[model samples]
Target: MLIWERPEPSARASLSPLSRDRIVRAAIKLADADGLQAVSLRKVAAVLDAGPMRLYRYVDTKEELLDLMVDAVYGEIPAPPPEGDDWRAEVRSLVRGIRGAALRHEWFADLLGGRPHLGPAALGHLDATLTALRSAPGIGDDPDALMRALQAVNGYVLGAVRHEIVELRAERASGLTEHQWQAAAGPYLARAFAAGRYPALAHVVGNGSHQDPAEMFDAGLDVLLTGIAAGA
Candidate 1:
């Protein structure tokens, strides 16, 4: 008498309710977890338990997928602050919102720098931000100054978020808090200062009162908004 045993399953598995939206979402998750370098149609297909070619029905190429993914992220930013008044305040709120969203998705700021294409969601965010700026009491009907203000706000927020993201990543890599980062670097800073080659740097480093990024962001916002109002 012989006993029968179960055999292992085959390699081919049917794709689950796979749709274009789902695939794009999976691609975003992959990028978020493994960095954008790991994101490709084939990789996303693997995660979806589908064949790589299946994604072609939705996205023509990885570039298309990236555009879609960015739009999806932009959609997450809160809607522009309420209309009708306090437009400068509204603009500031929107600025903070964008920065917060970018921080949540670290790839965002990097994406903003490389490409110029605007997905629907990106356009919406832009329109909303511009609307806030235009409506600001001080922005005053002058198109050029309004444009400058928008550009300044966008640049400031992007820079702030990128800086914060880098600091967070470095902290994680070093396993140190911001205070700890300062503490660990303090001694080296002191030793370098003792040499006296860089008086300006030494004075600034010795001050030990430089604001952290969060504080810097607030101060920068105040100065930028104040200047925008003055320019208007």
Candidate 2:
């Protein structure tokens, strides 16, 4: 059974006021202000103005706490569109909502899929996606096809968001904007291109338009959605 489904102890119900919700919230607050690494039972307890032992009443391990934190963030994702007639549009909307949530929680990309997330919010998000895919004109009741469509969109979002997060962290570490960093590295790239080793890389790097991250993400999403439609 999922952690949330486990029965709570009745003996200590009146003795302790802590609940899973409060523990999860405290952990999320710590993660938001600091980072995932800053979150611990001790720290969370301190945030709640309680002792570390008090937290043990709600959560047993740090991994469980992290799972709860992940679910809490998933709870922020917007629900799938109600119409659901346009599968592509619904998938696009859902994927973008997840991306936005990841952007807001910088640490989210690192901990995603760290464990099986069977929480109510996580299940709700998955069910919504399945409903949208099933509603697609050609998909119908084919489980395999529905899974493939879901994975295609979900995988793209995860990979894209992870790449974005890495680039963002790199920029922050270097203390330079993306353009500034590219300009600084231009001479090295020019030298490499001049060596005539990577013709394809040289062509794209030299001729490609400097599109913003969002535009590039949208373009890629469109390509994936088109492929799914064709397969459907």
Candidate 3:
């Protein structure tokens, strides 16, 4: 069973009393500063000024700690279960809420959609979203359509967020803005474009306007939502 499924143990009185929340928050801080690779039970215990084994009382393994961290992120994303009658708008709200949380916690995008999020906060957010979608015009009552819509939209979110984080981290690591990086690669791109075999790719790169990440995400989401809306 997941940690969330179990009742939380009370903190034992001591100089540094331990609770699951304290351990999870410390783990989150580690992940936020140095990414998921930095998180571990020992590290979290160290943050709490407690020995590693003490954390085992609340969290059994590293995986359980990660599960808690993901659920903590979900706690940050909450939207009203029902928002007027616009299913598209409602979904847009939920997606953007998720995006906002990811931006705040870059490592969050890495873990999200990577596993079954059965934690209370995750289930709460999901339940609210599906309930909102239940009011969607035509397909609301149809479980199959709802599931399809959920899967498609979530797939897009996972892929898009992963790409965005990759780019963002690449920029940070290389010490160059995306535009500067692109400019640095201009020669290689020019050579590729010169090859007549790649005409479509060349044309788009030559004439397509660059989009701010937020704008790109919004535009892509709308395109996707429009397709879903057609069935919606």
Q: What is the clash count for each candidate, in the order shown?
A: 0, 0, 0
Ranking by lDDT: 3, 2, 1
lDDT of 2 at 129: 80
Where is the poorest 10-residue window by lDDT in model 1? 1-10
Mark the regions of model 2 whose C-alpha exceeds 4 Å error after superposition: 7-17, 114-116
- Clash pairs, model 2 backbone: none
Ranking by TM-score: 3, 2, 1
Tens-digit lDDT string for candidate 2 (45-120): 8877777987776778998898888889889998866663687777777778778888898888888653447878
- In model 1, pairs of residues that clash are none
Prediction RMSDs, each to the true structure: 10.2, 2.6, 1.8
**Inter-residue clash pairs, candidate 3:** none
Cα lDDT of model 3 by residue, 43-149, tens digit:
88888999999888899989888888998999988765555787777888888888888888999998877556998888887877677666766676799988887
lDDT of 1 by residue, 1-232 (tens): 1001222223334546566568778988887886788898999989988787766756677877788788888878788657667776777777777777777777766777544447777778888778878876566678887778888887888778888888888988889998988898888888888987689998877675788676788888989887877767
| Index of the highest-lDDT prediction | 3
**Structural RMSD, model 3:** 1.8
Q: Candidate 2 at 188: error in angstroms?
A: 1.6
The CA lDDT at 52 in model 2 is: 92
Clashes of 1: 0
